[model samples]
Target: MESIGTSQIKKAIHHISESVFVGLCRKVGTSQMVAMKRDVVDILEMVEYYVKTSDYYIVMLSGSCREGFRLKESDIDSMFWPNNYRVIWDLSQSHYYNTQRQTLILCDCSDSPPGFTLLYLLSPSINRGILEACIRMKNSCYISSSKYRQKICSLSSSNETEHGPCVSGAYGTLEYDNAHCLSCDFWPPSASSWIERCHSWPQPHIVDDIVNNGCHFVAIGHKLGRHEDHEWRISFSLAEQKLVYAMNHCQFLTYCLLKLFLTEIINNGLDEDDKLLCSYHMKTVVFWVIQQNTLPHWRPLNLLGCFWVCFKLVLKWVYEGVCPNFFIPDNNMFLSKIHGYKQRQLFMRLYGLYEKGLAFLLQIPSIRSYIINVLHNPKVSICTDEHTLISEAEFDETLYNEIHCFDVLYKSDIQTCMRYLHTIEQMIGSPLLTQYQVIMLQILTASLLKDTALILRMETFTCKNKLKYRADKISCHMLKVAAKFGFITDMLFIAMYYFETRRYRDALSITEMIKGKLAQPYLMYESKVDTKMYTEAVGGQSWCTKMRKAVAWDIRLYSGIHYISELVSEQQSALRKKKTILYIPSFILLYMLEVLCYRHVDTMRVQTALDDLQTLVHYDQGQLIDLRHRDISWQILGICQQLTGNHQTALY
Candidate 1:
């Protein structure tokens, strides 16, 4: 990260231009390469003028040049190469090496990162001498026309082209005896297809594209369609220089992967599929947009919140006694009997929904903190035994009515049910969960006593946590009750199940789904039964270290949402002045619900555990003076390292 000297920057520019010159002129050979000398002179003149006016210093690297290795030009470039400095120097002198001695390689870490590390990110290497990456800077390589000439010159007349066959100069066909040698062998949508697909989307002038889209210049010839001798062909291969030159100097063909989300719907304007897809896209953008440094049209919370609203409106029809989308049946599914692919699809969709909703909440850390903090609030200990939650007459009457109505109503009506349940507390001084919720709980408890999953699971635990473990024990039973003919009942739980299995890639895809979040995704992906089954009672993903604090805030906020309903309930019920304001108990019930969620999610969530780690990191507010919480941005680097099997580095 150190600032490089103006002179070294100029020399680096000159070196690349020289490589390009040498790469381009086969007949003009090393003699014609002086063409780039003009570029060097121009760059030096500019740097000389700029140097005195600017503050800059040379950055160095500390490392040994890997032994007996070569480098590819398309890799990212740096001013110095500690790993392969001599090879770098050979190129700097255009391979006419002379008058250079080996110097100790080191960098002022305070001012700059070592140069070899920079090149390694930028360069392409293969052998241990100079370990080049296999996948990094993929779009930086290009097979040039000059190289084509050299290769063709080496080929005999027996074959029309050295690449196996030349359909024309612009198009040479490689006849690989072993197709596996091709980087993209038999995939349905080949690499070239992705490039063409991207190009097919609207393209603007190069400068405009970079100015508007988030492209920081791209390597020339990498992924570009070419014409030579009036023939069009694909060039493939890149080196470190290509990465450096393209990144430093702007280019027309830089790739913009974020542009992949440009989507629109037609044919009937926002049909169910369109509605869902739009929501999906919004969620994906929410995930990526914040991670990037760009001109954001809408921040993550605004965007995610908007999507949540849209999804509610779109799916609200189902709450009114109809199942709009069977894919996310209230039970959802996982380890399901249904087709594996369908299960995966449904789970991913649900994950997306929850992620959008949860991410929106996460982005508003105050709100998330508020919601979570209430869980730690103390219960009313001073109340006398005479002051019960609600009169039994009203509790019994509401319980009777609700049970009868719930038998016929869809379970997703839980929100409306929740509102109604909250209403009782507002009217009469009663707690929802403690009274009627207890009634419902009793019914579920009796039904569960007869189920076998509970019987077997109970055997796995000691008798002590049994009642406390009911939430963990009977989700499958409740799900069975919730299920129709033969489908699983919860999308979120399926996501959780998948997560427990270390299927996070699929879980990631599912979190992008909204249908999974609200509907029964395995006991709310936060139920005690779910959390305990998943073992979230520990300070895992579920129990935010500040859980006690966040829960307190949640109850206060959630209670405020239902305050008007509660006040009207109290006024209608004609409760006494001392007992009229019953908002606090309702807040307490909500607090318990969130704690359940925290516990359940802790037990079951995965990718999000790392996500929580990130929040915890930023939560430090720099108080620790240690870089323990490396920030959420570490997710990408960690994942990338894990993918490359760099477990130690990934852990670090």
Candidate 2:
């Protein structure tokens, strides 16, 4: 450590000392939670040491007061980064073993390449060993927290509780600037350099061992009024950010894996002794292998996760050869109990993707090449009909998550095929692979997208143009392999493409192709055994006959309007909310009134509909009530008048 009195490191340490933090806040008279601990460096040093020593590098230090009520008997809140570099200064060699309480690893990631960071609070371990394991686990990956945010934008006002920004690690130190700052209200740096200064923070020089681990941050927004803000105003939502952050992290890992893997293939490479970085890495390389021909941005992160998760389940089952009992709720994906050959294929693909993602993470290029080369392996042939060859449950989820299946398959899997081709091209230093690889890549561009006009220009050149090698069709295996993913939209696109080219018969033939499989026992049902029925009516219309049709219609029109799929995305959300507003007797009244009109039964239904309308009118607010209720009531009156035909009408 640097001398306690001289260096900037000493200044940071001095700043965090209880006397420093509390004294600073007290002198400024800002009301932060009373201090629970201070000096904070012991724990910081410990965390930093482990971070630097372990494969994960990049350690950050930000001080806290109460530790957010999460302090154990002398708990030190510090974030650690452990992607893969060993930090020389890290002191956390066996620190995880000492923790006695259950640990909670709060994650904030929602999705991943500029991966989103999550706030996951790992479940507390009942005992210390479990806690140790938890810490060890946290140590195994990159770590972070919102506390790192600046403590004050500018600690100007004693109105700390009022307009003052709360203290985060960097909270007070890194405001907009002096003039713009709350305290000085002036641009600290020049006005032009304000943004630049904020972005150009100095990376800490944590000993020679630590590598920089990127951070996942919350995008803070200022709300107008102090009291009039949403719950999320104080902090980012935990659950909301998981998927995206996880995805982005996956992408980053994929980029690194490809770099590492190809580097190995080019430079003699890894021996068998290297420890696997788990399935996450391999899944990425598998994705790279699939997407080798495409740009990095084209790869899908979640599908890779899906494949990895699927693989984990299968690996668990095959090792024991016993029936596995697990349910992938998103898809009724079961491992031990696949009912058919197709299902086995589905499991294999997901498992395969999982394996590849792991390979990518661990820097296993040989594994990547091995997996990629197997695309042409005679024994492990590509499935011709995905539903008939892979589990529909697994296929549907992987295929339909966000990107189109064909686009995803090409982007995720097929590109790996071309990556192999390109890899061969790179090794031989021959230009022959270029033309074939380029044409194969065009398969990614729908033959119909206008952009393909450029791709079409280079279509004439073949592997044969270079002499020795004959560039043939992208093997029947490749097409059949992709066809099994069972993507209806892809079929639609292909059919539309043919029709666009004036090949009506071919277009029609393609439509007839997947139509039969669309209705097959979508193996997904077995996966989602606990799936609940969605509310059929908008906003849970159990008996809201006279309820707010506005909310209902708003939901119905807006919920599924954009999702092109037949299975509406909001159908589950709307059903799950099962929102019960007031008892909407209007629907019942309307039904009764309709029956009365149909069978000429002059029942009490019309009057009830009228009463329900009046109740709605009474409860609703001024203008909004008038706007919402007026039309429905007027329509009811119109219907009643029509029911009467020429009968005398009375004013309400």
Candidate 3:
């Protein structure tokens, strides 16, 4: 078979995007969304009633249902926050006995006669009671194994196991409105500290908002013998719901399309027993892709490109046989499954689909109909004209919304820019640029202004330097405006500016915040033993090491003379062996930062700077370092030795 060409793939993606929008929009119409919300409220009430009688305080909707990306068959995932906390102790005693005829009788808790033999394994009896209460609640809510079997029988013919527990663990499904069903998973209140755990996550301030807003972890079902049948899955469902809810119409449509493809296309091709990938994986891939890229990349016209990117990400994960859990970096969602031959099979299947492109999708009758309907439907129209006045207005709004009030800073009249900036300050709830947004803004401003003084002023504002602030109030206003955005680089620049101005304590505080964010990924990576095993195999080292180095460099640079010992202690952990083949520019920058930092304080230890420069030269074979920096490093080394009264060593 001829492989799909690039143009053909693009065409297919365009059709797929249109069909997905029409199909999902129709399914999730105003009435359907209202019904979903109503169903969720009802489910919450039912759960609240059950938990109200117990120690649990609140029950909230979570997962796809809350995230507003649910399909026709998607389950409603929910968790209840427990008020009382109890510690569990494992009594590793076996819960089995031999039959009278010497036959091995495996006592199973989930069996017809629910065995209490394993009750010995549970401690304090309170946890056991809680689990039992949760099970009873599931049965009472009409989501028990028996209830599920009945529903299956009523709906369709299926020969699958009818006596097993729900895959989601203590989750129950109920018919919401005859046309839709709701599935909810109950969880015990998290014992873990969200503030401590999420300190290092990307965008610490946003994470702070999430934690303050009541996001918590939950104990979820894992493989039966793993971790004593208990594993805490960090639940970011609330945060995710907020993110998806805030997504523009186009981004949401793209997400729906990806989910649809996973369900209708990918799942259909896989064997019933294959659990290599699922819709959750698809959602995670999209979430990370969004975080790594800018908002403009996900525009409506770029819908096809976004979907293609999502598809490629999924394909990459399948091929690698690993998918890191989004919230918990160490938790490999596919750890127990997708290994060796199974992984190869999944890769081949996905690759084959990729190769076949739209031709394979067209072969599916339902999909073909969707495509045809999307193409001809009067209600669904793809606007291709960009020259219209409406289009221009929309374009301007798009730029305004994404670029935020900062767009006004680039106006032809400087006074007008300042006025708009002042207006934005007075306005409540103005959009603030993220770190990535600031970078883009910087580039845009530079490209448009073409004025070096203005650009330097912008940089000085970003740095938040007090030294230049007295010179101009405009620069001070710009600094305040940039501070509102709170970009990561902004903080770094501010810290550096403080350090340069000898405000050591203030610089240390900002550097600590940067350290906290950078350290989060490392802490997450270190928490899971499996992460280290798959680190290199899955391309984690590249990103992980870079983040570690950032933290290391920040500590070494801005930590001040008082905290130098801490930096020295963290050196080995922070600075891993560099990859010989890949030249990381950050490594060089880190060395330079270190050299500059050491020269500013503690001249006696300037030897450390010289050593770092030497290591950098050796690692990249001097290709990255300037000859001037190398000579300066040597001079610094000699000066430090002389200052330490080692004249002979300094001369040598």
For every model shown, what is its TM-score relative to the native structure? 0.16, 0.20, 0.40
lDDT of 1: 0.26
Task: Give the alpha carbon lDDT tens digit for every residue of 1-652 in model 3.
Answer: 2455866655655755655444445454322342334333433243234424343345555566556543555765655443343212121211222222111111122311101111111222232333342223212311122332244334432322222222232112321211111111221123133334443233576655554554343333344323323222334566676556545556666677776777777786666577567767877887667766634455545666777777888888887777876655545677667778888888998899889764555544334676676557635655432232132222222222222212222233344344333433343232543333333334233222222223345345455557457533453344434433432223444444444555555555665565465434322211121233233232322322332232121111211111122233223322332211111132343343344455566555446655665565556444334333354344444544554456986697
Highest TM-score against the true fold, candidate: 3
A best-first ranking of the candidates according to their TM-score comes to 3, 2, 1
RMSD of 2: 29.6
Instruction: Tell me the deviation in Å of residue 173 in model 2.
Output: 38
Writing each residue's lDDT as its tens digit, candidate 2 over 1-652 gives 4464456533332222222222222221112111111112222233234324432233333321112111111122222222321111123322432333323333322232111222232344343222232212234422222121222233333322212123222222222111111001111111222123222111123211111221222322222222111101111111111111223322333333333333343123344223222222333333323222233332222323333443354455434333311111111112213345644554464456456544442334323333344334424332222124323222222212211211211111233334433432343343533332232223233311211221221242342444311221232223233333222223343443343334545544564454443333321211221112212222232111111111111111123121112113323443344421111122322232332332233345445534554454446443223343344344444444444442454234
Candidate 1, 1-652: lDDT as tens digits: 2456865544443333222222222211121112222222222222222322222222111100011001111111112112222212112322333224221111111211111111112233222222311222224332222333334334323333332122112112312110001110111111223223223222324223322211111111111122221111111111111221222111100011111111221112434332223322232232222223232322221222333433443233222322211111221111112234543453455446455543333333213333233224323122212214223222222223332222221112233333333332343333423333333333322222222223233343454676535744463444334221111112233333234334545544444442332233122211112323223332233222112111111111111112122123433332332222222221122222222233334435433444443343345444221232232234433543443445897798
Q: Residue 202 in model 2: shift from native, Å?
A: 25
Worst 10 residues of 3 by lDDT: 112-121
Which portions of model 2 show Cα errors greater than 4 Å? 1-211, 214-489, 521-652
Cα error of candidate 1 at position 457, Å: 73
Worst 10 residues of 2 by lDDT: 177-186
